[model samples]
Target: MGTSPDRSFFPGSHWLYFSVYLLAFLVGLPLNLLALVIFVGKLRRRPIAVDVLLLNLTVSDLLLLLFLPFRMVEAASGMRWPLPFILCPISGFLFFTTIYLTSLFLTTVSIERFLSVAYPLWYKTRPRLGQAGLVSVVCWLLASAHCSVVYVMEFSGNSSYSQRTIETCYQEFREDQLAVLLPVRLEMAVVLFVVPLLITSYCYSRLVWILGRGASHRHRKRVAGLVGATLLNFLVCFGPFHMSHVMGYILGESPVWRSLVLLLSTLNSCVDPLVYYFSSSGFQADFHELLRRLRGVTAPSQQEGSMELKVQKEGEGQGQDCTVQTV
Candidate 1:
């Protein structure tokens, strides 16, 4: 198959995109799948929200890896998209769905964290696992529906097939139809990028503020460092991609700029699990404890089974008071 015109549309991107896609998939898939099992199997004692979110994020990243293989193949083969035309739309839809869901879950985690620290009483009153499960289901449904807009618009069309004699699963935006394309692009930017970002930033900022006011220097430093890493990740990995898209919408989409945006966006997927580990105390503990056991640092923590973990600080040297307190 010849490289589609779109392949040549952004020359030199194939090499970079293929490299990034392969790296992300190879790294993210197993990491997330293992995280999924650990969160479900060992970390079950934590809050339902935490577990549910871990599951959701795992699925998101896993789905990205699943969809990426084809993309990697396409890029390696110079964007010829050797897969069947029918597979294109499905692939594109699934790709967008997974990424948006990842964003959604990340934002949700931030909100949950903010409440846990800043509004303890309110956070405690919120539903546990059952509620979190329902919310997670709702998130999946909502994300699926929202991202399916593209599928709905170009679900099946021989015009993209018969006329061009080229099959594409994803519909190209009509470059001339600025009115229609612009609004949809704007909405995608807002829902998938801006809104999630604002929510995450607000929650993390509030969490940092609350933690800063507390007395534990060790805890504060660790949490601060994690939060800083997380925030930096968002700014460095995701911020530029969305900002570039918005800039393109306002200014113009030069090929070089678009390729750069895509590159940054791809980098986000690869870096996200590290972000999760750093942003979350629970994750950091779990991951560190896992590595330590692997390296023979210490024995793994005894398996605490099937009860919620009531988060608390180090013991204050009181006998009966050593029981952990929930927020």
Candidate 2:
């Protein structure tokens, strides 16, 4: 059976991991929930394809954030799995599954945007809302199926360690375990990470070129922000984790630094809100409206009548914009 590492490569860094996880949980949870509310509200009024995809992306981020406290607990225990052994695989499955779901949903959103801009006439002819729902379901199934390997490797029956003896949740692969895990990891890296990344890159590049030719400066800037955030998410948050998959396959063991790089992946949950803000004018309008209402609530001395009138006008404006640019 595979053996656990002799010692954590960064013995004193568990606090760092815990701190980052705490911060991400605090920030990502509310943002994603807010995005969820906004998307649901918009969809209830009028269903749009991009909004459907964005809603799924918001849900993916929320799932990742919800399962993150498990990691936080493990980190607080200095990267040890102190909880019941059963919790490890459950949380790990949701954690890894949702991470890849983010990649797929983001790629789907990019494709939707690219098609809307690059082939507006053809895009309109399709039944987009139904298509987006189908795509979302497929992405979830694909990621969940791929990540189920977590359960397989964890319970391979060859491990010498019993539940009480195992120190880590998903680390310390034995030779037999590594033989199966490493190849699967490499395949996941190629299929889930690299392929979606290449597709996103191509779609965004073509998107920029198409918009540059005749789109307004404001439109171009919004697209630029969306593209930049999505790519930055792939490069900064996910790049290192998947690279570790490749490196682990080649080295025949998980790298000592693999745990540290996983923190970057956790950070993606917090970063996805920026993508939501930039990708949808409806989200921006609703977000700003929420802030305005909060301000009004806090400052009761402000003329209630005037504030209500302003909000009404802004809502009307938002409705018009949502009709034109729901994507």
lDDT of each candidate versus the true structure: 0.65, 0.88
lDDT of 1: 0.65
RMSD of each: 14.4, 11.9
lDDT of 2 by residue, 76-116 (tens): 88778888888888999999998899999999989999999
What does candidate 1's lDDT look like per residue over 172-258, in tens digits? 444443334445655776887788888888887877788877638876776666566556546766676566557656753322344
Clashing pairs in model 2? 2-174
TM-score for each candidate, following the candidate numbering:
0.76, 0.87
Q: Residue 311, candidate 1: how far off, in angstroms?
A: 51
TM-score quality measure for candidate 1:
0.76
Where in model 2 is the C-alpha error above 4 Å? Answer: 1-9, 125-127, 158-165, 300-327
Model 2 lDDT at residue 55 = 94
Cα lDDT of candidate 2 equals 0.88
